[model samples]
Target: MMASCVFSRWKIPYLASMYFRGVMRIPSKESFLCSRVMIPDIECSSSKTMWGFKQYHDGRPRGPLWRGKKLIGKEALFVVLGMKRFKDEEEKLQKFIKSHVLRLLKMDMIAVLTELERQEEVSLAVMMFKVMQKQDWYKPDVYLYKDLIISLARSKKMDEVMQLWESMRKENLFPDSQTYTEVIRGFLKYGSPADAMNIYEDMKNSPDPPEELPFRILLKGLLPFPLLRNKVKQDFEELFPDQNIYDPPEEIFGLR
Candidate 1:
């Protein structure tokens, strides 16, 4: 017999070997006009034969953050998002700018700043926020300001937080319900119940009436003072009769 020879369209015959363990052939599955592709290489050692891949080099890295010696990737993104802790806010901010994290798209940058806030890296988050403010293409975004406000509020930087709130208004950008909620929460955190109530009043007067959660949250946040909590408690009860409302513990209201 012909040893069952395999042939291509051009009558190309395979090299038949009785000791052939596995099939082998040149990979032509992927080919481009001018692109590097994974081409397999045959390695034959003293004891065995194996197939390996030759490294594919596509000239150079591509993207905004890709460069000669200062290429940065996911690791840099992690550091920018506060996954890799820094000694101080300035250090983190410097790394963020140096890593070219801001070179990413605006939507991506917003997410990163939000992540920074979630990680409680407020100081650096604030600095990066100012950098964003100075950008010519920067548009007013409620969530961006909200994240920074919450971060600053937690850090007890209420002065700057309110300043941002006022600036948001002057730009004709209104705070959504969730934004109002966070700002109120931040005010409560910083022991500024008066300012918190002012924002709450604004929330109540907003063109769009806020949901019950903000009312409940601000009500709970008013535990330190009996007068305010009682007033909101009634309004909260009136708003959501079917839904159960949780009141702060009596002790929080100075009851034994």
Candidate 2:
């Protein structure tokens, strides 16, 4: 008689019909227990599915898990150390890189080149950078050029800095304020005020708004050249009118 009655818990008429069909034939103790328990299990499992194991309504699974930034791999370490080790022996270094560096992945090559730049191994870093440029995957990345230029400028390798700067310009990459400051300071320190002024002109032409730091650096460096210093001072006053220009006494420039 109970089997003859439709199950109210199963809202679907088709599901209720199926349940009644099974119940009508079977009066076993196990069947009676399963019918009661399995209904809750089906309802709860569908509602409480884990996000990680979730599927589309059509039942397709998600794609691959996301990967984070990878660590510097063993190949990168080996290349960095090898470049350092072979620093004095140019021929041997060439051979070493040719033999081992080819196997390195893109990230590994970038890592090794960056490490070399950090160590101020300008020649090695530049060589590896050129190698990276030759790679099929090499795109014109501003940050890569920025780091190398900064390192070269700090080391007073103006020739290399100029070469990299030209290459960067060819690719339409403009240096940031920090880079312009470092490079201008480098030229001034290298006793090339003319070159420093040339960079200042480029900075003036840059599409990005000029920064105060580079102006300050140029003013300080151009102190010996009052004419040049006056040009920068006037511009500084216009761009940052509220800011005070620290005009050190003329004696500092040995003018007094």
By lDDT, the best candidate is: 2
lDDT of each residue in 55-127, candidate 1, tens digit only: 4434444643243123334644564645235535666646657566556666556655655676677776776
Q: Report backbone clashes per prediction.
A: 0, 0
The per-prediction CA RMSD against the true structure, in angstroms, equals 9.6, 13.3
lDDT of 1 at 209: 61
What's the TM-score of each model vs. the native?
0.55, 0.71
Pairs in clash, predicted candidate 2: none
Query: How high a TM-score does candidate 1 get?
Result: 0.55
Scored by CA lDDT, what does every candidate get? 0.66, 0.82
